[model samples]
Target chain A: MKPVTEAELHTYIDGALSEGARAEVEAWLVAHPEDAERLRAYAEQNALLRSLYNPVLDEPVPAALLAVRSHAWRRYFAAAAIFALGIGLGWLVRGMFITPQMLPASLPRLAATAHAVYSPEVRHPVEVTANEEEHLVGWLSKRLGTTLKAPKLAPLGYELVGGRLLSGPQGPVAQFMYQDARGQRLTLYVSRQRGEPRDTAFRFSQEDRVSVFYWVDGNFGYALSGEIKREQLLNVAGVVYKQLNP
Target chain B: MDRRLIIEHIPRLRRYARALVGDRYVADDLVQDTLERAWNKFYLWRPGSDLRAWLFTIMHNVFVNQARRRRYEIEQAMEEVPAVSVRATQSEQLELQDVDRVLRSLSPEQREVVLLVAVEQLTYEEVSGALDIPIGTVMSRLSRARERMRQLLGGQTVMPLKVVK
Candidate 1:
């Protein structure tokens, strides 16, 4: 064995070296008596440092030092919830502003106003007679640039009382009225815009208790307005959507 | 590792913290800080893993970083004072205080390695993780620190002078 380096001496004291290294260092040190004494002194110092600090672990931890549950977790969860809500709201607003899918909400208000204005008719109800239904249909078709067919109201026990030319938010509207024997009335408002594509389902939106069933098909939009039961409105809307879309 | 389980280990953490930092108040504060960090980032911990080691790692890092910052701040503040040269004073008794003085005399890195290995009794693997050092580095650091501690203690005691005619 060769002379032990200072590193090997330290490793020997700390018991970190392999057995081969230990044996080599040990044999080398046995030949060097003075280095052996120094090694013994180094070992004692290591032991003494250990003994001095080891008692700290046994000492009672002060009550103040313990890790207790904190209230900050609530704040963290609240912050996460707020972040999610903000993202959701931003998406909803963006969808509403940028797409026609959200146009239903605004339709009910317009429908309610249109119904209030036209339902009080006494004498002049329709612009043309049902006897001149063909001429009236042809005129409206030319003016609206789309086919205008009145919806059948057979299921509701009402005849086509009359229909008149009216104006609504989108453009010129065709208001078709229906009446039962009890004289309860309902109105269907129709309009057209080349850019607003046809929607194919009966979508009811309500404002001030008036239900508006509005739909689009190809280049025309139809809105039926009435103060009616939800089921009755849906039934009328069903007929309107089926006739236009079909 | 949820904090409720980690919080349950607070007694042991406090004990370890006290052992690491000599001052009881500083130890307690370190433990509290460690707990606060763990609780705030509790979701960051995976469900099944070593919670105790994870917590100790946090605690050890917080202590080291804080110690380094405090040292730097003190050094900056003390720069204006008249620099007094420190000379070792002979003490009458060989008490734990003497051992503490010897330990403090070692380089901070050496003291950390020595304490983690000897006092805390953490394995080389745990010490590596806690200190953010490689396992091999931990082994070498512990070996060197042990040697340095031995030399400091040897110098403190009065004995027959070695290699002096």
Candidate 2:
């Protein structure tokens, strides 16, 4: 039998050793009375530590800690509002000099707002489940007058949860929801709008904890929204863009 | 990063902070600062990584910075006032106060290792990652901490160290 080191003894006390190593340590401790006594003291110390601090877990989290989320949300919305105001001012100023076709559409902002409202839902997150993928695609395609395909995001650890039909300014919008193993949801919003067939570059925007990456491919506008980091959402956006465009 | 995902770790963060600082208000402040910093730098956090360990690392760094600042304040205050030894009461019973005193008797490094292992039940790997120390250092510090704790709690008077802020 390999001799148990002091670290192994500590690991035994922590209950982190493998079963075989734990058995070996226990056997060694039984043979050594002094080591057994020391282990007892360590166990008692662990109990005391838990007794002293574990109650903090049971205590209601102070309001200040809970306020962190709300504070972040407030900051996000404030920034988003400022950004929207800037865009609105820019459009107004630009409208004076250019035609309506030159003004960018507000579909991205709409998609972001829809994502913020619906992604956090515990229930009724989508109108149809992914199990009905064929029917869902057919229905959404007919409603939006485009061949709408739910992007396969399994490679990214996100599976299609479902989708819903939302009303857009131009026509119907199809929102396909995907969720990862961690229950984080991302929404892909697609709608056919009056735009020339030109591959527009991906534009990014954030609104109240939700990030959106939107672009136009021909007449269809697509936006991917999630509460993930920008780089991660961009990766997912790239995957969606390839699937839809290919 | 999702705010909700970060929010879910609040209770554990508070518990760890309280164990580190040994004061409710100070610990709460540390937790708040940690959360705020985490929010601001959420972009730096990698997805699909160990979020809890990452949060703990942030908390550890914040606590160390605050401790340094508070130590400076204490040094300035000590020059103005006589040095008073705040010794733990000689109580052998395993009461909560006795446990707290014994824990406070340890140096910050030892205390952190001990609390993270014994109280937070973090694995040695996790503690190493949280404290940014080598795993061997965590084990050695933890061993020393346990020995010191035994000596102190057994009614042996260890030398009074500087005040833990």
Candidate 3:
């Protein structure tokens, strides 16, 4: 048999050898048990790595990470148009353009709708639970195309209750839910805005059952919505904005 | 079908990312950025070509770029995962000591070569294209990584082989 090179040994360990090459290595291994042991060690390394991360294959893909058909391109163009028209003329202009019939999906309306739908759930409120804060933060940040922080509303008596990924009219949106002592829930809905960084001061909108305070800072549309009092929601929104921006 | 093709490879992309970054969140972030880049460059992907290899090539680029942006974070991640220690004596137990530590023990380039070859089971040619390194570099890195793993899992127990390259 030909002398087995180091590369060939590694090849046999990876099972990359041709039948003849594999047979030669097997024959050689019988004479060289040390080489066999080394080959076995390399095989074990592969097995260990495969077993360790193979679970990721079985993990249900995060909703934020799934193959979402880009449904919001229309809303994407609308939002871009909205921002383009205004030199920071902001969401009021957004409000005037959206007809009641079209409703066309403005930030606060979407935020409030998400809040109304999700906050009332007695169980299973979030897609990524708060305990997995790292994954939740990382997932939301990527989808929104910005580094997102689920603002610590702990000072305002609201604790992060986890978050979910929602497909909003304007691209992928992230809703982070926070709960107060009385079980009242609030959601901070975020959507990525197009174009350059432009600031839109806080815009307040009262939907059918939810009050929302939303604003656009740079490239993100943020709406803090809840069934809580206007003053209370606003206060929490202020805290959220400061924590996110600051 | 184009979209699903990208989605189909996400699991492997994620598993490789986890091995690369050493944290689930960071791993997902890597996968997300890879997916984002893949989408932006979707037109560049030739349909009939090895989609899996192309996706991995894109991920390799993303990982390299992100590593440049956050060199400090990668350094921190390179540390032995907290629970794994040299005290792990038995070869079997050592192999099981948080694959994170065993895998992260290799340098980034070395780890990439090993993972692509052993874990992903890509051909040496595929790894060369994916890492954009020469096939010779891939082979050398693979041997070095395997040798490191052998020592990492108590190679002292086995007699050393005669060939030293």
DockQ for all candidate structures vs. native: 0.12, 0.28, 0.21
Off by over 4 Å in 3: A67-246, B77-85, B88-94, B156-165
| Model 3 chain A worst lDDT run, 10 consecutive residues | A96-105
Residue-by-residue lDDT tens digits, candidate 3, A71-123: 24335545776688774564555555432222224777878888888998888
Chain A (candidate 1) TM-score to true chain A: 0.54
Docking quality level of the chain pair in candidate 1: incorrect
Model 3: per-residue Cα lDDT over B34-141, one tens digit each: 877776677788878998999899889988888788894456755543423344355654556545576776778898998888778999999999889999999899
C-alpha lDDT values of all predictions = 0.63, 0.77, 0.75
Interface RMSD of each: 16.9, 11.8, 10.9
Superposed Cα deviation of residue A2, candidate 3 (Å)? 1.8
Highest DockQ against the true fold, candidate = 2
TM-score of each: 0.46, 0.55, 0.56
Model 1 CA RMSD to the hidden true structure, in angstroms: 27.8
lDDT of 2 at A194: 74
Order of candidates by DockQ, top first? 2, 3, 1
**Residue A46 error for model 2, in Å?**
0.8
Clashing pairs in 1: A198-A216, A198-A217, A198-A218, A199-A216
